[model samples]
Target: MKPLLRLVEEIRHGIPSHYHVDLENRLAIAWGERKRKRFDIKPRSRGENLVATRENRARIIYLQAQDEDCLLFLAFILAYSPRSCVDFKTTEFVEFHDYALDNIQQRASPETEKLLKTMAIRRGFNQNLHYLNYMQTMFPKGIREQEPIGETLVSTAAESVGNEMRIDEIGRDDRGRQIERMYSNGPISQVSMFGELLSNAIQSSHQWRKERGLGESTTNCWTTMIPRDPNEDISITIWLGRRDGHRVNTALMVEPTWSSPSLPMPE
Candidate 1:
């Protein structure tokens, strides 16, 4: 199947009757804007080649009608291969869209329906996280976890390991002193257990970073605190890169003030 056709099928399944060729350019524009980047679509001298390429690609568009308001959108799901590009056919495209629509309708409760329009935005974030995870697994060494203060967790962990490897000089430095304290407090020699925990945390953190759009930056930081008490299950905070200062400030400054005071919080 063509990549565009697969995308179309996915979109149809996810979004239903909202697909149209006329809206392809607009959909592409919308995608680029949301990503804050321009898509590289080759310019064609004639419409035939453009249409042919689009048809061969795994893409799906749907015209969503809710009362009077209609929304036309397309989704492209392409997986680049080393040898060649595998595209999705029209049937695959439509099937994917149908799947998407069914998934959406399954969650069409009164409360969820109120947020239905925002589903595409959420889906984009989810897809980004999926891609990030795949990339992390492929290039584990390049995946660095930064602490809140902007130090690499992997480097810190390595230094800690080095210090632990020297058991004779246990209390030589602050790190060694901390290790001594841990050794006295509990079963701290379980290196394998710690490795497993750290590995899981790294994977989870990578997914979190992608979901938050942190990208590949040394300065970005993400933290999550889970209290022992049941009152606070999870608390998350993110610090963006210095280059993203404008975006970070804008997000922080706009959020508290923009929320609807009268709207009930979700359960």
Candidate 2:
């Protein structure tokens, strides 16, 4: 119950201001702020906006009842909620769940383990096995920014800017806008000419990713040619750091975890 409450609180904090309390609070209240009452509500469209609503109602009922038999049911609901970390819209929800599960498993809670397995079974064959697999990978320790998983090509013109070691301007984007403080690794000129090349490459890569639907310029490793001679192809690496599990969410959206339920299902 405490973990559920914490998860709910996290969703409340992570959502954008527009949907913050307006939509989220309805979930919190409908669940069980007072004595619970059940009623059927009709949907405007093909029930597109209603999955979260139904899940919210169930969460309240379970929370208020504290039914031991329903923990698996509750976990599944909580895991799929748009408010949950799996959705990729709100931040830190997955990490929170991962941390909480680690604590539970560390204490040797078989019931929790059984609950997870049951949820996995339900999700795997009926839905996505990778969902549970990815969730397990995040266990013990969550996705780490220090580790850059994949590299994206920025530009072939690496040597073009390697010599112009503009120390003061390294962190700025192509248009001269300052990069987000967290994403900016201050002037890399002192590191090497390769550093400047990498810095420039990352700027271009961010722009490229933004223009295409490939992914966000949010978190990734940018790689480009670091030439020994003007034509010699060597490479240098520059990592764009992650903020609040941004990379994790992006990864989930990319492959095995990209399992956003179908349009009929609420994202």
Candidate 3:
């Protein structure tokens, strides 16, 4: 197996040239920002690519960059404010709104584990080991576990290429414009085949637009397997899109979540 450092290097190389910042750059910047008291990375704004690395920067390159590597961002968040991660996808507390949501669901990320542990010790959370045990069960299911159950070794998009193509049809309005849906998840792993396909799709979309002499394509979409029934335990990720014409909002959740995961009932 290749070393972890090699993996990061390769994955970073795979990042589309459009991206302003990649994971490694963000971590280095976040670490430096710690020395100053004020939160330098502005928590808000709409950007297509990452911004240049600088303290007190208005944009978090990672938020708009890609979906994976949120672990580093959260790791920094943990160092600064651990509880904010509990609301991983839905924290309006910061100006960067949904910045944390970019690549959530990365529980087992090594960066997350390492920094979280270090932050715990630094913050004195490790004074008692029990707290670490408690921290493990927080939100996303796969953070600390070394299992790849949540990751896919194959590309669902590639696997489906040339297969029967079916688009979810929706009734049109009086104007006869086609209604579109949006879907995708982040915290996508650099090592996973599924993520690679998504990355390819994004890159392809950019080219597709340039070929047509068009600007960015508004048809941002993503898919996941999901269960067909409430009673059955079987699950498949169904493709879902954002209702609003904006990017995924951490304030809301992916479609058909219907209801948020019931947080543990009050004690």
Sum up the clashes in candidate 2.
1
| lDDT tens digits by residue: candidate 2, 1-267 | 455555444433233344333333333332322322344595344354465455544444433222111212233335344444223332223333333322322221333333333333332221121222222222212111112212321211011122221112122222233322111112323334434444444444322222123222222232232222344334433433133234443644744423223213324
How many times do residue backbones clash in model 3?
21
Q: Give the Cα lDDT of each candidate.
A: 0.28, 0.30, 0.29
Candidate 1, residues 10-33, lDDT tens digits: the string is: 543344334332233333322322
Candidate ordering by lDDT (highest first)? 2, 3, 1
After superposition on all C-alphas, the RMSD of every candidate to the true structure, in Å, is 20.4, 19.8, 19.0
Lowest-sum lDDT 10-residue window in model 3:
157-166
Q: Which candidate achieves the best lDDT against the true structure?
A: 2
Q: How well does candidate 1 score on lDDT at residue 52?
A: 41
Ranking by TM-score: 2, 3, 1
Q: Show model 3 residue runs off by greater than 4 Å.
A: 1-72, 80-94, 97-221, 226-267
lDDT of 3 by residue, 59-171 (tens): 23223222222322333322332222233443232433233234232234443444444443344333221222223222122222223222331211111112111112221
Q: RMSD of candidate 2 to the true fold?
A: 19.8
Clashing pairs in 2: 31-60
1 versus 2: better TM-score goes to: 2
